[model samples]
Target chain A: MNWILLATIAALLIPIYEAWQDENIWQTMLAFSSIASKTSIMILIVSVLRDDWTLGVVGVIILSVGNAALMLLAHIIRRTNEL
Target chain B: MSEQLYIIPIVLLLPLTGCMLVLQVNPYHALVIRGIFGAIAALVYVLFGAADVALTEALVGTMLSITLYAVAVRSSLSLRVGAIEDQLKAHTARELLSVLRATFSKHHLRLEIVPYTNLLAMQAALRAKEIHCSYVLSEPGGSPSPPGGGSRYDIQTRVSRLYEIMQAEVPPTKAYLRYIDLANPDKSTEVPIPEAMEGKS
Candidate 1:
């Protein structure tokens, strides 16, 4: 559990580093996805530590639906550019 | 106390450090940095055994807001043009480019021009979406679209507006208005998406 917390803290810095390094829209999107997945994983880890399935279910919902919404928003923005 | 308790302060401190780093980045990069900040906050929540709050942060803070920021970035306006070499050589075609520049400038759009070797090459570029609008010279009496046949095959979205501009501005030529089917408003040269991909979510 201690190692998991450390790993989560380490993973949280990646998007900040990426944003500081590059300004391209694609790079920003990749960073966002990395952060999303990492945070969801952290939620799953904490729920396990607490012996709580309800909290785990919330993490699972975010893991499945969150990235899809981001993808859909990207698609919509691309469509607006076409106009 | 368990050794895990020591990790809590470090976890909490990470977001504050990240916040300072985010402030250092430019506004465009800052938007991306905020997503990282949200994830770190979620991690801090997890360290406190507040799994529900961590889950909320992961969904609402990290993903949803990042998508919104990206959508804003993707809205920049642009237009692309493609033409074959022979068509570009025509005096009227150069005039057409000037007209296009003037017209698109009104919309504050940046135009990109690509030159191709032949009509087929231009068509291929159009299909690949390397360029939004393509121009080609067609010889009169070219039945199935001659190599240099004068025809502009445009995407459905931009075709009508382009046709209106061409009709009003471009001087009549021997092959003028030969290929575009203004007669039937619905026909498109490109094939629709495949059935298999269309059925997928």
Candidate 2:
């Protein structure tokens, strides 16, 4: 279980590095979406590890809300590009 | 008991992402990194046994605040320049617009076009502070200044900082740049055109 969480943290670094180095706004957004879902997944894993129901529920909410935020951001950015 | 090993690294990730967020130079890119920071913060909060705090951070900090800030940055970081509608279709107008875009982008400001039906309407918008600048096409040797009447273009800006910026970057030959002092009531805002100006937005 510890190894699983450690590996997930390692995977999370990939997107962070990508977000930092990429100059394109869309690419940074892509990395942000990746990091958002990955972090929420980590929260869920922690919940399962500790058997905490509240943490589990929060994880689910964050997971879904993150994607919705991404959708809103993408639309605004697209309008900017068109204009 | 041995689980303490990964906790240090997980907590370390917080500062790592935080640093990246601070290092971003562009406002739009910074906002995206801010979302990334909020996500990591929520995860760290949950790790520290603060479930409710984590939930608030993810919802308000990540989702709600990011959306709001993105909207604010997109709108505020732009310079609104008004132009007469029909004159904008001219080939010279296109060249002038490209030059304006190139100059403004260097300062991280986006140029937005606000079209008005006529010269009077555009001047009114500028005096009302609805636009930061206005582009006028004057007639050859300077008169009437009908839409696309001449190659000569006039760039008028009420803002001093914008005037200074353009005064340095935009050459006088390309377009005649003027700084209008709106505070002085005596200064004429009127162009010599005789109601011949027409444009579309």
Candidate 3:
């Protein structure tokens, strides 16, 4: 598979997925995910074009689990600091 | 040359080449030489529209290389002092005999141990040598005998030279030890004396 093309397709489709969610809360979620999705797609393209299998696997993991962990950590830290 | 794009790789390799060259030179020369090369690289980067990278290289390269040079000079000077100390430490009986044997094998003048092989012993040996210098390990705890003991005129001259070399190379703290002339002076020398002996004399 052409990884650059796949990455380009993913970058385009993510916005559509965000758009399908409700206009209020989902809009905020979409805005946040958009940054993660863009970074992931860029890393994915670089990894595949460079033929770096480790980077390709790690980039996918970061795009999935790393983004979730970052968001969760940010939320917890913010709430604790507020208290 | 449509392949002018290869210039990017060449430009990136300049710092790596500079680093290798600096590593091979005497550390004292590394700072000034590296800074000059780095400045040329910065200028090249600016001409090629990498002003941001150029600015970073100019500031960091100049400051870091100069700092490294200063540290290297200080460390080399300290090492010289440490070498002298090691020679002195070997003046104990067993080592003294070994050193005397070695000296005889290599030198034209015969080596001799005069008086006692203590700090005062150094003065005697230095004076005793007509064609070569003598080595003495200053004994710990004894009061220092006067400077011109055995051959005052000859020993004084050699001691003065040794002191000059030591003063120039050693750091301030270690330099003070060379000034004492006594076997056990004070704790002023960066070389630590035992706590029990500190206030005794």
Expressed as tens digits, the lDDT of each residue in A1-83 for candidate 1 is 77767676676666646755664756876876787787777677777877888778877887787678657655654564354
DockQ of 3: 0.01
lDDT per residue for candidate 2 within B159-179, as digits (tens), equals 888988887887555676777
Candidate 3 C-alpha error for residue B97, in Å: 22
Going through the candidates in order, the fraction of native interface contacts each one reproduces equals 0.52, 0.80, 0.00
By DockQ: ranked, best first = 2, 1, 3
TM-score of chain B of each: 0.39, 0.83, 0.34
| Candidate 2, CAPRI quality class derived from DockQ | medium
**DockQ value for model 1:** 0.25
Off by over 4 Å in 2: B143-150, B185-201
Backbone clash pairs in model 1 (N, Cα, C under 3 Å; residues 3+ apart or in different chains), count? 6
- Shift of residue B109 alpha carbon in model 1, Å: 11
Residue B183 accuracy (lDDT) in model 2: 95
Which model is ahead, 2 or 3, in terms of DockQ?
2
lDDT of 2 by residue, A2-28 (tens): 999989989999999999995799999
lDDT of 1 by residue, B107-172 (tens): 555566677787777666655656667655544343233133344222222355665554455444
Scored by lDDT, model 2 comes in at: 0.85
Question: What is the model-wide C-alpha lDDT for candidate 1?
Answer: 0.60
For lDDT, candidate 1 versus 2, the one ahead is 2
Question: Compared with the true structure, what per-residue lDDT tens digits does model 3 show for residues A1-83?
Answer: 44444455345444434433323432533443563455455445645555666555545654565355335433432432231
